[model samples]
Target: MDVTTPPASGDGPGTAPADFTAAASPGTVTLAWTAPATGRETAEYELYVNGRPTTVIQFGAGAVPSGRVEHRLTVAEPTGTAWAVKLRARLPDGNWGSFSAERRITLVA
Candidate 1:
């Protein structure tokens, strides 16, 4: 899959997260990112895999910006595969933030 660079700052819904990371093991890949200090309570996170929107992860009402968020994907491929993953924060107003830096991971069999 193609790797997409994050958009310029102040271009999208909000600021993107920093220090994005990903780890892969067997059939699963885990993605994590530092929360942004947008001053809005994040309601959810949109996860993109291979440039496609794959899932939405919801946050608690009292979620803190200093905390990190993580999501694990159970890939369906038997021989493993390479994936480009990114994340965007969703505010309580239902607006999405700029995508975090993309992280690439290769799941091994």
Candidate 2:
């Protein structure tokens, strides 16, 4: 019998999360996004702050079926420093997809 491995999933995830936003209050920043279609696999989200990978957030199957995922991060940047926040999702295959549109926010005291 001939055996062959199935083709790898082309490229990466289909599309990035559509609704991504960030807000800053005092010394913390809040990021939120609607769960993207994961092609039926669990998705791991990566958070990029000012072009650096800062954190990874995971969403299991059916984790956020009705609402969006939100996280609050404490920042120590000086006031008036603008920060760029972006997000990307990874498939179970370890491929990181395109990043979401960046959201810029200035920190407050």
Taken over the whole model, the C-alpha lDDT of each candidate is: 0.77, 0.80
Worst 10 residues of 2 by lDDT: 58-67
Per-residue lDDT of candidate 2, residues 1-109 (tens digit):
9999999878754457668999999999998877667765435789998999989877666763434778788889999999899998775567877788899999999
TM-score of each: 0.74, 0.73
lDDT of 2 at 91: 56
Best by TM-score: 1
- Residue 96 alpha-carbon offset, candidate 1, angstroms: 0.8
Model 2 pairs in collision: none
The sequence of per-residue lDDT tens digits that candidate 1 reaches over residues 1-109 is 9999988676543367778999988777778787777776566788888999989887576764456767677877766577888888875556787899998888877
